[model samples]
Target: MASVALSGKVAVVTGSGGGIGRAVAIAMAEAGASVVINDVGASLHGEGASGSPANETKALIEATGGRAAINTDSVAEWDGAQKIVQCALDNFSRIDIVVNNAGILRDSIFHKMDPNDWRAVIDVHLHGTFNVSRAAAEHFRRQESGAYVHMTSGSGLAGMVGQANYSAAKLGITALSKVIALDMGRYNVRSNCIAPIAWSRMTSSIPEDSPEKKALVEKLKRMTPDKNAPLAVYLASDAARHVNAQIFGVRLHEIYLMGQSRMLRSVHRSEGWTPESIAEHAMPALQGSFMSVQSSSQLIPWDPI
Candidate 1:
């Protein structure tokens, strides 16, 4: 697999200190891609920075006979993001893949959420994705080949309470992925998103104040970080060459091809009547197709199995 599929390729996985990012980095290394482990070593809420996590992942990859380099640049800044992609060239001489797995959560309910919290999450998730992907785009265009695997979330794809900022940023990632795929397809560069359902540091932050929530958390725990790594690896490799601009979800043993924004039902009026008539006629015609407001848990109410 290495010799034929991914040998001589380089991959940069941002926020790779631990959890999903770390898992993806290790998987990339194992699949024969020289990995750049980029992490700011921040907490779940984007507090503080250290180099320990990135170093540990680098060591783990090397100990298992995989080549990896540590990079501690935050993806939120264009300069920092540029350095991350450049790290691959410096260490491996070329880059073939970018895994936009870096993220920090600032989950808050809509009413009480502060502006700072919203901006922080958007900066890291949305802007960071753009910054890193844009930085890599230059090389990808010149070489005429590259693959991008971005970390989206159920919180974004599906509704979740107390996470308006997160949801918005996440859903926005899907749109960005779609556009990149469309714009870069001529260059053989592809972009795709993964809404991973894993019990990692990110999920550890979920409130567990009641038995029901606690039980849900337990089910979540079974969906370990590694469960999502294989899909990321496949997406980054040439194996998914024909797959582009698609949204996927990795949940335990289930891999879902999630839906994008598409019209379910459309109402057309010959005359385009007044507001009241339209509301009365068009709404009734469209009401059956209207989506219900449901959180991620409510929609997937069954057990993980």
Candidate 2:
């Protein structure tokens, strides 16, 4: 089989200290793209910062004879985001691909969630994606070509208990990527989202002794290890130029494209319809429409460009 290569391209991956981000950065580098790896080196809750993770990933890439640089900027601020992208421009001269994979979790049920928790998660996930993508989009438009991959979560699509804040922010990322893809198509910029189920530091906290935990672990084990980054690497390559504004659920040896359909039905009005009469007639339709609006389905047989 022929391999997908990204020679002559410059790529940036955020939060690449470890886990999926690390895998993606290394895969891009191996594919011949000079990579800029960014990580705040914080904990799962976005607390604290260190340079160890970023430096370690960079060293590993270089050791493997790949081109890479370390960036230690938090994506929560505009200036920080700008510097992260600037690292790519300064080192590689231009950026052709970006994977907004930096994220943190502030999990809590809606009632118990504090305002600070909600705001913090939103800042890092939703606003962080905006800051980085906006800076990259400008350069992308100038170059007339670029690819973006935004990291979302299955929780955002299916919803999970005690993760109201995290889920909301992730869902916002999906929406943002879709809108960017729609608006930037004319500029030859393609933006897509990925919801991945992987075993990372973030998921290690779940106990493995329980039956539910064992089942979840088995499911995740079925997902390819960090080596299964080609799926994301492909999305960040010229090969996927035609794919835009879509979401994919990535696992080891499996790729599932997420399909969305319209939730609203067309409305027709009759002549001389009064407000009261229309309200009376619409009650049953309104109730019936609930099912369609709430309905969501997972795509079978994963495929990507």
In order of appearance, the predictions have TM-scores of 0.97, 0.87
Clashing pairs in 2: 223-252, 224-252, 255-302
Which candidate number maximizes lDDT?
A: 1
Task: Please provide, for model 2 over 1-305, each residue's C-alpha lDDT reduced to its tens digit, 9 standing for 90 to 100.
Answer: 44468999998898899989999998899899999999999998888889999898999899989999888988999999999999999999999998988888877778989999999999988899999999898999988999999989877876676778878888889999989998999999999998887778766665688896687666665554374477788888877888899999866666778765465764456765678766877655566665432211132223222
| Backbone clashes under 3 angstroms, per model | 0, 3
Instruction: Flag clash pairs in model 1.
Output: none
Candidate 1 global TM-score = 0.97
Error of 2 at 274 (Å): 10
**lDDT string, candidate 1, 45-151, tens digits:** 99998999999999999999999998988899999999998999999998899999888888777999999999999999999999999999999999999999999
The residue ranges of model 2 lying beyond 4 angstroms of the native Cα positions read 1-3, 207-210, 222-228, 264-305
